[model samples]
Target: MEETSSATMKAAVGKDYGEIRDMVEVVDDQPRPGTPREGYLVVKVLACALAPGDNRVLSGRTKMVQGPPAFPYVIGGDVCGVVHEVGENVEGFKPGDCVVARFFTAGPRGGLAEYYEVKATLTEHKPKTLTPVEAASLASSGTSAYIAVENTIKEGQSVLVLGGGGGVGTMLVQLAKRKKPSFLAVTTAAPKVVQDLGVADHVINYEQENWWEVAEITDQAPFDVIIDLGQGVSAWKVARKYNLLKSRGQFLTFVGDHHVLWAQGIFQIFQSMGPPLWRSAWTPCIPGVPTFRWQLDGLPDKREPLTNLFKLVDEGGLRVVLSNGSPFPFTTDGVQSAMEQLATRKAHGKVVVKVAEE
Candidate 1:
């Protein structure tokens, strides 16, 4: 085991904020996982999932990486790997244990590298039935989707998820399906793919039919809840135009509540620093409609949220959709290719990068 101290590992590192290829480079001299500080453990990564937020970070679009960051930083959020070492303060885990983690803190974001460090509090043992790829896909997107649904949705209500074919949308579909809403619909170019998930009762093909023009979506509108997992502000336009949300219906967007502010980096950075209280300062231009985004700090307990999701998987109640029906190999090219797919938002489900053979 001492030999681990002398090992060098391959890692996809971000040298600057720009295009994926230009900003990211694969390097082999990266140091291997070493002994962790208290409350943390080292895991030899097996798989890591590509997140859209990562693309934003890579493109220098987000403030999450605000302040001067050291060069050659690695950015990844979700991973599943084998424990290689543990700190004295860490409990309930030991070397060789399979675990899943979501590490959102700064500094060489541990996920894209062959060896990663995760806080014990944010880690959970992988469920017995899931493959490492499946486990890796759940941390960031899964938790975001779960937090969105858990906080806003109520039983027997009508719900609509835009961009239902993407990673977070896919997880939102599965989690929402378990709630058994009165009526469920999703907007996607590939209606058949969403239908195959058995999560949506009505699949509206946004490519072929205007959301307001489609009877399947409109009839079910004035919904009790609308989860906007889509990319742009078009969904908000549709929601306001069609009076799609009930007076008290909750509208949740992963793109942030005041997404337009995102275009204004200064204001976005200000709001990003706080709890988005700025939203309350101005009323929605469209009265009687409520819209909000998931707050990073307000999310439910990390370990339990994922543990419950994994329980759903173990019970055969949930499924994770991977891009192209397979995991991308753990290599520089593979990581870049996966990031590019996520940037297009065309991926059917979460894009997972296989880091090592399990």
Candidate 2:
């Protein structure tokens, strides 16, 4: 082994909470990007996205997780960056690879700072189809929607997507169509936009109408799949309305009590029902999807996830919509703006805090 020096960088910390602005600070002494092995890779962070989840955490939604945590709790998730170094034994990726990955939840700090580690399995080849920012947004948000819609849905079945204009909701629409579901219904703040996605056969505005009624779901027929991206009361209303197992229907949702959602640990209690159904009975998550070594090489190239997702996008099954404005992106100083956007409950797509490439 040879000796190497670690580098320092700037980062924003989640020091306690009254508000994000008061809490986040640019801290020094951060680790420089470095590789752990010849095959291991490190990324010099280009950007990290701030979403409602990040905002909620900053604004004392700590009950959703392990704690109020601590001061200087760095906040940010999802990233796209250039490869800083590759360990001696590393195979394909080189020092200059421009890659994108969902690196936040799996590690300590995320794409917020200038650097972080990259797992080969989860990393994609960054198609000429997307930019770093777009890739960062897609890696996590897009992937979640893809999994929820594609993995859970069957071909030619009608589906309902609640909270349908947000980030994951948009992806859900795109991926759902790729499955070639026969009919699509959506409940969102923006009715026209969801319809424009081409996957939605019907779009109901959450503000002016009852999504269930407009979808004609309750009286007409039940949906085969329901994707919920929002949480609490409203989500329950939709879940209870149409979850029919005999019809082989299921509900897939990402928003819930994070404190209870530990690695899908809650599934053990539901064992009597059989392997946990994500949102709907029809859509079963891939078993043994997460493993100790899965991240090291990025999401598997040979695995069906990437290839399936790409095919969907190529077929116009997946799309990325941008919020190109202030208050659209979540940030520290922009806490009030972030909160206002989420609180108004008006956004139709993913709201992100843009960190770089202004």
Candidate 3:
């Protein structure tokens, strides 16, 4: 990696876990771009997005499945940028290549700065059609949704996506749409957006009425797959009570309960395979049900899944839906507003923060 003269870079620092305003501040003390170590590269971030997971960590609500982040952290994991520096041992990537990266598991402080350092394995070449902001918005959320669809959803199956207005939800809906499902439904506050965007065949306004009570939704029970992005207890209970899922159906959730995280973390402090072990061991025993959480720990490399996502985008088969009037400027105020909109749970598709000009 070549040297840059600048000694500091601007970053959004989380002083302590709390409110958005209290937690995040734009500061100039962040270290300048670093020389890449072996198998790593430094990126000049053009865009970074705010995911719900980012706020969960900022508010001290994250369950610490792997480990907790230190105080005064930098927040954000999704990044779309140009390779500014390449490590000695890296291959297939060089300086000036446009790439996308997901660093949620890397550490607490990540892409929400002028420059970010990440391993080569976690980065992917960006598709030509996607701008930096669009690519940033797709990183972690897109990868997870794509993998879930590939693993669980099948063509001609009926599908349900809870919380379909957010980042991962939007991607899940689009991926499922591509499969030509017999029936496709999504729970979102903004039904018009889903309809206008043609992302789902059925749109249930979760705010207007309970999902189970909606005749349009109840009529389509026993769906072959239900991807629960909302993680609402009531909705989960309703699905079980109404037999909304088929016998061989799959119910997958990435946002498991915080209590589960607490248990996982506490037990891990003593034994390595503790709560997560129990979860994996016991979840499959329930009679006549197929349920599983998105497994981040010990997961295989995401190259295949991410490559498929890029192909979808390049082929014009996938569309990224942004929240209404977004692509928020990269400023303290812009980031704060983005987090607040996500907290409202009414955002239409993903919310992205434009970090810098491409």
- lDDT of every model, 2 decimals: 0.75, 0.56, 0.75
Locate the minimum summed-lDDT window of 10 residues in model 1: 256-265
- Quote model 3's TM-score: 0.88
Q: How accurate is candidate 1 locally (lDDT)?
A: 0.75
TM-score of each: 0.89, 0.74, 0.88
**Deviating ranges (above 4 Å) for candidate 2:** 1-6, 27-29, 37-39, 59-71, 104-108, 215-220, 231-246, 257-317, 326-347, 352-358
Going through the candidates in order, what is the number of backbone clashes in each? 0, 36, 0
Query: For model 3, where is the 10-residue window of minimal lDDT?
Result: 255-264
Arranged by lDDT with the best first, the candidates are 1, 3, 2
Using TM-score as the measure, the top candidate is: 1
In the predicted model 1, the residue pairs found to clash are: none
Error of 2 at 312 (Å): 4.3
